[model samples]
Target: MRLTSAFSILCLSAALGTAFAASPVHTSGHAVTLDLISGQGTANGGLNFNGGFKGSKTFTVPLGSVVTVNFQNMGTLAHSFVIRKGGTVPTDADATDAAFPAAYAPMKVEAGLKTGMTQKVTFKANKAGAYYIVCGVPGHAMGGQYIHLVISKTARTASFN
Candidate 1:
């Protein structure tokens, strides 16, 4: 009877594992595409990304995946997007030095990306950890325009919160 009970428990655990494994995280091959908009809402005095400010939204992608960010400036102010190493909002406004090389907008102006424009930045998630996507424009991220980003070692697909 004890052997039978053990077998039943093992089978149940296996079944549960299989059920969870069947629903893998979705991904676009080995790529993750994301959209980010500046000043979609009246948050943080309009210093926001995708209507979220102060790291209100978190994005995650699998390690080694090529990530593409489709960035748009819909706000009234100049804004630029950049990927930085830390999650802390930088006290300074300069956010151009990206943690990962090639993880910044290609058409970024010194002032910022002008309002009513769009740009794209692509890079590989080579590290597994937390990061921040912030505005590279002076005084923009310092005013509160950034979001949390994470590269997961175990994640099979990309997701956002």
Candidate 2:
């Protein structure tokens, strides 16, 4: 009877540990993970290219938190990660603009490739609002290939909505 009770307690403890570690990311508390992909748009094909061909996604994080993004570059050509300031949108949907390198945050990975590559970066979610994540490739940011990361003041309460 004693041995059986001990075994049961051990099992329960292990299960609880796993559950605690598996908690979903929150907005203002712990660090969250963001996965992003980079590539070219229709403009790359040519000026005559009619169809848009770009990839992007937005992620939400908590205010004053940390985030880890496992980004992948799955496009033909070199690409880079650039965090731009708010309210600096381009007039052309596919136009490129110059960003402040000093203010821009870059996460280094292998040179962008068509086959795809992965890079992990961690940053503080100091700003409590919306921000843009884009590829520094000449015209990539102007394309639809950009992601919006919104940091809120609550824990695990962020959503694309």
Best model per lDDT: 1
Best prediction by TM-score: 1
| RMSD value for candidate 2 | 9.3
Candidate 2 off by > 4 Å: 1-29, 40-57, 90-114, 158-161
Local distance difference test scores for all models: 0.75, 0.49
lDDT of 1 at 149: 84
Worst window of 10 by summed lDDT in candidate 2: 46-55
Q: Give lDDT tens digits, candidate 2, residues 19-109.
A: 7863223333376655454553435442111112232344566775667655555555655555554465521221133122322223331
TM-score of 2: 0.56
Q: What is the overall TM-score of model 1 with all chains considered together?
A: 0.76
Per-candidate TM vs. native?
0.76, 0.56
**Which regions of candidate 1 are displaced past 4 Å?**
1-26, 93-96, 106-110
